[model samples]
Target: MTHYRIDALRQTLVLAAPSDGLPHCTFWGARLPDGADLAQVAASAALDLTGGMLDANPELTLCPQTAAAFPGQPGLVVRSPDGTPLRPVFTKAGTKRTDTLSLAYTDEDLGLTLTFRFAADAATGIITASTTLDSDTPVLCDWLAAPVLPGPQLADQMIDFAGRWCDEFQPVTTPWATGIRARDNRTGRTGHEHFPAIILPARGCTNTGGEAHALHYGWSGGHRMLAEELPDGRRQIQFGHATASDPLPGTRFETAPLYAAFSDTGLNGCAVSFQRHLRDRIVTWPQPDTPRPVHYNCWEAIYFDHSLAALTAIADRAAALGAERFVLDDGWFKGRNDDTTSLGDWTIDATKWPDGLTPLIDHIHGLGMTFGLWFEPEMVNADSDLARAHPDWILGPTTQPLGRGQYVLDMANADLRDHLFTQITTTLSTHDIEYIKWDHNRVLPYNDAAQTRGTYDLLKRLRDAHPEVEIESCSSGGGRIDFGIMAHTQRVWLSDSNDALSRLRIQHDAALFLPSCVTGSHVGPRTCHTTGRIHSISFRAWVAAQRHMGFEMDPRELTDAEAATLTKVTAWYKANRDWLRTADILRLDAADPAIIAEQQQAADGTRFVVFAGHAGTSTQIAPRPLRLTGLDPAASYTIDLANREDISSLSRGTPALKSGPLTLTGQSLMSQGIALPYDLPDSMWIIEGHRA
Candidate 1:
């Protein structure tokens, strides 16, 4: 066996090529100690490769469960032109780069050439696997994967998430049972069912300790993630294109890279690693230096009540509240009074604004705030003129249920996609639009992968054309968030349920794969439109500050005290956003599951911010000491509480907060956590750390 290894970010990926007559490679996931021998480590952990050649033990293969072998669920399955199974035989392989490895295989009978590639990043500990298939003659690929990982030992627990439209990223954990545990999302969009991620916690891994292996499919559209434990003691985790596509002969097809990472420091460690990797390596297009403006979206402020005078007034108030971007969300276009009509009509409503949107747009610009518009380009109402003119453009058997009185356009249709792009481009080309809140309110029931591919193409083309404009992927609030869309979008609206208390969990789970910079968190109205829960302005703003900060409420409704709170929070975020955008995220564990605290640390260890979430359900009056993470233990620090005076509790004999910032050693602070005062229920606090 020839062993190859890539060491990165305190992790190592070892690949072994079996010289025996078997057509299988082995992958070993090892947390290498210093001066470890790659070959020796791999050899000691190698699987027993003694089984029938046609149906061998899956644990021995780099990609377990091949179609010809174990037969439960193959990572790659292809058929010949004659409709017979086609399996490739290994030919040759080599290292393309220090971080990348390539292996070639061919199915001569079917005239198909297959090459698998693996790449790793040493600093972030992210490993990616992908495959490219080229065919000389026509062939059909039922399914193809980027790379499959050999099942790891001591993986007795599984973790995944599931939620609906308003509530997303609800974590679900189960004991690692035998047989295939497949979690798939076929809803044309990423959907509300499951996030495109899966995790297997090594036997005893907890929030702060244990080993964790996570797999994430990078595609934004439909995708699948599975954790299968075969009867033969092989536990494999694989993710691939969930959308079905039939490639023709002479065509080349490459699956999106499947990213996997390992961590021995627990789940939060994995999350912090992922956050840093995505922010630094993947999200490279949108300049990190570009200030993420504190936006005031007019969605909850005045839904479907768009008018030049009203919007201008809102813009004035927004500017006063320190809003840098004034977004006119929904109902600005022609016949767009409700969700029912004018979806495909991109023209500005002349009836609502006699002159056009220029007056409002210019007014917003005059306030020193950039203008953003709402658009649902891939949707159309039956009452829309575009839909009437092209009835067949609606994707369906014409029997699909209407969501929000709308149907998804046939984005897969080239002509329809071209027309929709033209309509959107015309608005962007004519207006001084700096941002677009691209929304998709429904799902495509029909399994058409081409629709997703086409949407990606359209977004790519638009991005290429207007590189200056930033787009937000908001599928009725986080329905279409993945690395694929993250590649094109600047940020994602985390959820439509902006209730601060609920947002705590939503944002917490989102950080599992996304960086705080790309997660759109906004302070909504006092009474959330979705949950009807009223929360304090300070709490809302505090929760939002930990993310790409923004506001979704009407500033005109704010009291003097509320305005002051908003201003204070906005300024704090602006002052610290540089580090917040690129910092490492640490989700602190507490005895109470309802209590949430997150810390963001500057990479240089110079400063950090901690946002503490209160569900107001704890029976203990003092709660507990809130310890911090990602700090330089050797350094001295000064801690300042943003809401110091407001820190009062109903319990008697509790001490008041200090008048000024307190100085202490990082070691002391981390080991013996500072006591936080609890006030009202559903409250929040911002604690800052500065190097002393």
Candidate 2:
């Protein structure tokens, strides 16, 4: 038997290969001491023989094989060109170790080779693993999972995500069962309904305490996830591209990287790992030294009605309200009076602006703000010039049903990608545009891995040409958000619903995997256009301030008092954004279920800010204590209610926090907690903390 182990600062993964077969993970948890024996650890994980079992239990290798008699779903499903299922039994071929571990196994008779790669990052505490298959001849791959890992035995329930448009990041918890729990997203995009992530919390786990494990499949295209409990009681997790997403037979197939993490410090540990890895590692920023600008998008403000006078006036008001960037949303392109037409036409509308976008761009720059434009480069209206000229460039059948009056551009076609690249770059080169709001308003007709890869290629080519421009991935809001797409983009529109009440919960849950810097949360109109519910400017502003702050509402509609409140919140966000951008967002455990709260602690642990949002009325009469986490227990700190003036008149009794700042040890604040000022539903209280 041979033993191998990979260690990060907080966790360790040990694998064992017995009798020269593919290695299987034997131990994965908290870091073992440097002097610990890996061989003994592998031996300790061995199970005893039982009746009704095979003469010998087959090892659950990284890629469990059907030929090996593994009693579970095989990790790799493939067939010969003639459609004959191939069961390739592999043996150890080679190994390489450095910062990352690579192991190769070969099935000589089948002329196939399988390789597993693992990398442990000390800084982010994330373990990224992937699997690749190479064959001498072409083969049809139905499914190919990233390196499979053992599920923790101590976990009683698993947490995944399910959401929809306007409502994203809804956590769904399920108890461990005897059979498989599978989720497959065939939408051809990183679907809002099926986020590619899973969390396994132990029997007794919370946000700030106990053991937990998490895995994020970093693929923007559709994916499949399986958490299976075998008849023998062992569990395995497999994540891969959606089954048969690759239509054509090929000699080489590979799975996207699967990011795995172990956290002894509870769910927050896993959250922090994913957050840090995505922000610091996966995403590549154009201007790393510049602070994130306050964005003002003119979508809900002026949907398809484009007038130079109205937009210029709106830019002035947005600049006055502290917006540092102005994004001119849809309807800029020629003949695009509505979503039904002119999607693929990248030229500026001569009727709306006979002088072209230069006037608007110049006016925005004059107001001391940068300019951004919106584009749906992957979709084309059937009535569009590009589509009518090259019908073959459109993906799927001509009789296929249209989505949102548009057909998906054949991204897999190099000619189509080249055309888009030239058209988009022409505008970027001709103007002072610094950002692109790349929107995909509709899903593809079918799942195609090549389509996603082709999109990535185009994005890379664009980025290489225009290194100064930033991109935001917006798919009708939250549909195309994952580490895979994030690799090419800098920001994500969290959701389309700008309702503050809904945003509080969505942002709270999304922070489990996304950091504050890349999540774009915007303040909408007094009456939300999507939900038709009205909210006070104060509630809306604070919720937007929780992430990459922006405004999506029309400035012309704001009353003087409402504008004042927005300006004040915008100033606050700007003042503290430097630290908040890099802060670790810790979700507070509010004793009151009605309150959705989070603490943004500075990297140095010297200062922190807590946003306690009153989502609804409490079951009891008074507010309960909200406990904070991720603090040095022995340190002394001063806490002040930044928004004490927002307290409601409904509560007659005064809470200590409503009066003045209180000095206490971190332990006291974490254990006993702080009493917040009484506030009504849809209101939020801002509390600032500093080490004393």
**Highest TM-score against the true fold, candidate:** 2
Which stretch of 10 consecutive residues in model 1 shows the poorest summed lDDT? 20-29
Per-residue CA lDDT of model 1 for 1-692, tens digit only, reads 66666566756777666653223434445566757765676657645554543343434454443533564566666777667876665444433554477776655665666677778887788877787878887667767766667657787778888889888988888777678778667787787677888877788776567788787777876777777776556677777777354444335767777777788877876787678777777665545567788888999989998777788898898888889998889998898899888788888888887899888988999999999989988898888999889989998855778889888888878898889888888989999999999999998856566787888889988888888888998998978887777777878998999999889888988888888888888989988999999988888998988898899987788999999999988998898887777788877776555578888888788988888888758877566877776567888999888877466546344433345677878888777777776556788767888998
The alpha-carbon root-mean-square deviation between model 1 and the true structure, to one decimal in Å, is 2.6
Per model, how many backbone clashes are there? 3, 0
Q: Total clashes, candidate 2?
A: 0
> What TM-score against the true fold does each predicted structure earn?
0.94, 0.99
> lDDT values of the candidates?
0.77, 0.93
Q: What is the lDDT of candidate 1?
A: 0.77
Q: Mark the regions of model 1 whose C-alpha exceeds 4 Å error after superposition.
A: 19-35, 48-60, 65-68, 81-83, 87-90, 93-95, 243-250, 285-287, 649-659
